[model samples]
Target: MYLKIDERIFRELFHTYYDRLYTGFYKKTGSYEQAQDLTQQTFIKFWRYRDSYNPELSVEIQLFRKGKLVFIDWLRKESKERQMIDSLQQQEKIPVEELSADLKDSLNQAIDQLSPMRKEVFNLAYIEGYSHKEIAEKLNVSVRTVETHVYKSVQQLRKILALIFIMLHL
Candidate 1:
C-alpha cells in the first residue's frame, strides 16, 4: 500500500516527534551533540525512505527503529577503532621520554606528510580530543570518513614511530 505523505504532514511529524527522539538518543549517547546529530540523521533517513515505509507502522516506531540502527552502527564502529588503538598502543609501548629529540622531529615530519584533510581530522580527533562524529560535523564530512582519516593517521604514525624506534636501537 502506497501512502502518500505531503510536506506538511512530514513537517508535522518531525515537530511532534523530534523532541522525544532527541531525548532517547541523548540518554543512550550521553552527549548532546551526538544526540542532536542522530536525531537529525534519523529524520533525514525517514524522509529519504518514506516511500518504502509501511503505512501500518506508526511514524514514531519507524523513526525509533532507524535511530536504534544508527546508534548501534556507531557503537560497533567505535568499538572496532578502540580495539585497533589499544592493540597499537600495546605493540608500540613507546615512552615519550624514550624518543630522542631527533625521533620527535621525525614524528612531526611524518605527521606533516599526511594529506591536508587527514591531518586536520587527525589533529581534531587526537590533539583536540574530539569524537569522530564531532570532527565530522566540524569538517562537514561523514562520520565514516572521519574514522577513515583517523585510522590512516594512526597507521602512518605507528609506521613512522616503529621505524624510528628501530633506528634508535641500532
Candidate 2:
C-alpha cells in the first residue's frame, strides 16, 4: 500500500519488464514510436506514483493498467485534435489566400503570444514541417517536451483563432 520503489529496485524492474511492456504497447498501438512513447509514459506514471504500489497486487498488472490509461489518454487527445482540425476547416470555408490581412495579423499575434521555445517548436513543427523527433533532436530535449509544446501551442492558437473568428463575424 505504501511501498516506495527505490532507484535500485526501480532500475531492476525497468530492465526486467521494459521489453515486455514495449512489446505489449506496440502490439496494441501498431506503431513503434508511439509504443515507445507510451511505454515511457507508463514508466513515468509508475515513478510518480511509486509510493502507491500495492505489494499485494501483481506488478505486471499495475504496470499494464497504467499503460492502458496512458493509451486511452493518448487516444482522447488525438480525437480532440482531429475534431479541432475539422472544425477549423469547416469554419474557414475561406481559402488561405483569400483570408483577410486582418485575420492574418490576428493569427500572427496569437503565435507571438506563445513562449519563445513554444513558438519555435510550433514553427518547426507546423511551418517547416519538422517531425517531433527531429525537433527534439534539434532542441536537445525529449520528444515528450516537443510534443507538449506543440500541443499546447496548437490549443492556444485554436482558442485565439476562434475568438478572432467570432469578432470578425460580429
Q: Candidate 1: which stretches are off by over 4 Å?
A: 94-108, 114-152, 156-170
Give model 2's TM-score versus the native structure. Answer: 0.61
Model 1 TM-score (2 dp): 0.61
Q: Model 1 Cα displacement at 14 (Å)?
A: 1.5
For every model shown, the clashing-pair count is 0, 0
lDDT of 2 by residue, 1-170 (tens): 47768999889888988998899889987878888999999999998998898988877788789888998998998788767545543542334456688987887888998999999998887667777799999999987678778777888988988998898899
**Model 1 whole-model lDDT (C-alpha atoms):** 0.80
- Per residue, candidate 1 scores C-alpha lDDT tens digits across 1-170 of 95567789889989999999999989988878889998998888878888877788887787789888888887897798878755643553355467778877877777798889988987787656677788899999877678768788988887877887788789
Runs in model 2 lying further than 4 Å from the true structure: 96-101, 104-170
| Among all candidates shown, the one with the greatest lDDT | 2
Residue 17 displacement (Å), model 1: 1.1
